[model samples]
Target: MNITSFLIYCIIITFTPGPTNIAILSTVHNFGAKKAMEYTYGATIAFGLLLVISTLLNTILMTIIPKILIVMQIIGSFYMFYLAYQIYKMDTSKPTVNQSGTFKSGFLMQFLNPKVVLFTMTVIPSFIMPHYIAMPTVTLSVIAITLIGFLAFITWVLFGTIFKEFLQKHKKAVNVMMALFLAYAAIEIWM
Candidate 1:
């Protein structure tokens, strides 16, 4: 495997704005850095779990992947729309950490996020399976990828923390913008 290319793909995919990242940013903007961190931890755990699942399931019948992808895409898209609606209506005036920023929410979101779902499904097969067939090597690869994902989540949290004041100043506008981004991502999965 081209380590450079693999790393690039992992970083770019995890770091990019998507449903989970936007939610994390919105969580920080509204609730606080602590809430966002909690969400990040959940997301990171789910991410690693997904990687492991993909690795184990890679040997299954390739013919069923298309069907599985379709189901995931539909579920993920609907979930994104639901999240977008939640963000759009967020009352930033009364700031309170709720279920939205909880670890469980973040963990569940990963399973319903198409960007994350697709990334986990493809990354293992493309990068690790191609070069490293040993179980230990594959386990290490998953850990490294999970770490990269955690770093990406932390970066988003820090960004929200750093710009918390500015983001809160225009909280309503920011939420709407983030909502639209999530909606756009949901639509983009098909094309």
Candidate 2:
């Protein structure tokens, strides 16, 4: 595999603002660093599992990916739109009492996030499958991707912690901006 290109792609996908990253940011801003780390750990584990599942199912997916790609994209777009709306409607008046930063919440969020799903599905096929067909190579790639995802989660949480006061002061603006980004991601998925 083109390791450099693969790394670049992984970095871009994992580091970019997405539902998981946004959740981590919001969690840190509201709950505290400890809670945010719990969330991050949960998300990281889920992401790793997803990567493994995607790798294991690669052969089956390759056969059907073309046929289901459009459908998956549509589903992913709508899901993103929903998330955008939720972010826009987020209540900033009080720190969320909704357990938004819990480990379970983080796990479920990553599990259901279409952005992660699509990233896993495409990355394996496009980057790893073509060149690194060996089982050991695939396993290593999955591990690398998972670690990158963990780092991304940690980075976002740290950013949120650093800017927690600012986020509190400008909660509305932050929510709106994040909502808009998610909306754009939805549109991009469709395109």
Candidate 3:
């Protein structure tokens, strides 16, 4: 495996704005850093689990993925559209004082996110599997990927936190932008 290429791929996919990152940013913008961290931790745990599962099931996935790829993409696209609608409809009249980010929310978001699933499926099988067949190497790669994912989550949270004031001041604009981005992502997945 070309480690450099693999790493670059991982960085690009993990760092790009997706459901998880968008959620994190929104959470921080509305609820603050502490709440966002909870979501981040939950997402990180989910990401790690997904990485391990993807690595362990590489062979099985190879056999079944071709059959399910279209279905998964369709489901993912619809889900993204739903999320976009929700974001667009967010009530930004006031800060959600009671809306502390929950671990379950973060965990479920990543667990159900098709983008993350696709990322794990493709990256592991194509990059790690081809180059490192050893269990140890695979494990290390999973750990590395999980850590990188966690960092990506943190980056988004930090961004949101830093701009919390600005976001709150222009809540409608921010929400609309995020909603549009999510919609675009959904359409892209289908295409």
Candidate 4:
């Protein structure tokens, strides 16, 4: 496998402004980096698990029930919408304490996110050569991807943290924006 190609793939997957990153940003702005990092940690684990599952079941998925992927997609989108609502309703005035285990929110969100699933199905396969690549190598690749994903999310969360000084003044606007973002993600799933 070409290292550059894999690196490029990781960069794209990690940096994209998807639901996971959006949630982290919102959480950071409303709660703070400490809470947001929890989400990132959870999300990273979820990401690694998804990759491993996909790699192990690649043949099964590639052959049988490829279409059932749509189900995962729909479920994921709905979850995103639910999370968006939570973000929209967050009480920015009171910084929320991290009640969910350090990474519960981030972990579950990333684990269940359809967007991430679709991305994994689409991109991960390209890097993996089923014939040449051994399972151990694929597992390592997944781990690398997960680490990159964690860092990318951290960057977005930090962006929110930096913007908090300005965003705090306009909490209502941010809520509306979060609501709109959720709606857009849901609509995309249907399309």
Please give the distance, in angstroms, between residue 99's alpha carbon in candidate 2 and its true position after superposition.
Answer: 2.0
* Clash totals for all candidate models: 0, 0, 0, 1
Clashing pairs in 3: none
lDDT score of model 4? 0.76
Better of 1 and 2 by TM-score: 1
Highest TM-score against the true fold, candidate: 1
Residue by residue across 33-92, what tens digits does model 3's lDDT show? 889999899999999998988888878878888766777777777877887897798888
Off by over 4 Å in 1: none
Task: Note each model's CA RMSD in angstroms.
Answer: 1.1, 2.2, 1.6, 2.3
- Computed on alpha carbons, the lDDT of every model, listed in order, comes to 0.91, 0.83, 0.85, 0.76
Question: Candidates ranked by TM-score, best first?
Answer: 1, 3, 4, 2
Query: Is 2 or 4 the stronger prediction by lDDT?
Result: 2
**Which candidate do you rate higher for lDDT, 1 or 3?**
1
TM-score comparison, 1 vs 3, better candidate: 1
* Residue pairs with clashing backbones, model 1: none
- Runs of candidate 3 with Cα error greater than 4 angstroms are none
What would the per-residue lDDT of candidate 2 be over residues 55-120, giving only the tens digit for each residue? 888788878877667776777677768877877898878657646678887887776677888898
**Residue 46 alpha-carbon offset, candidate 3, angstroms:** 1.1
Candidate 4's residue-wise lDDT over 55-92, tens digit each? Answer: 77777788754576777777787787887777777776
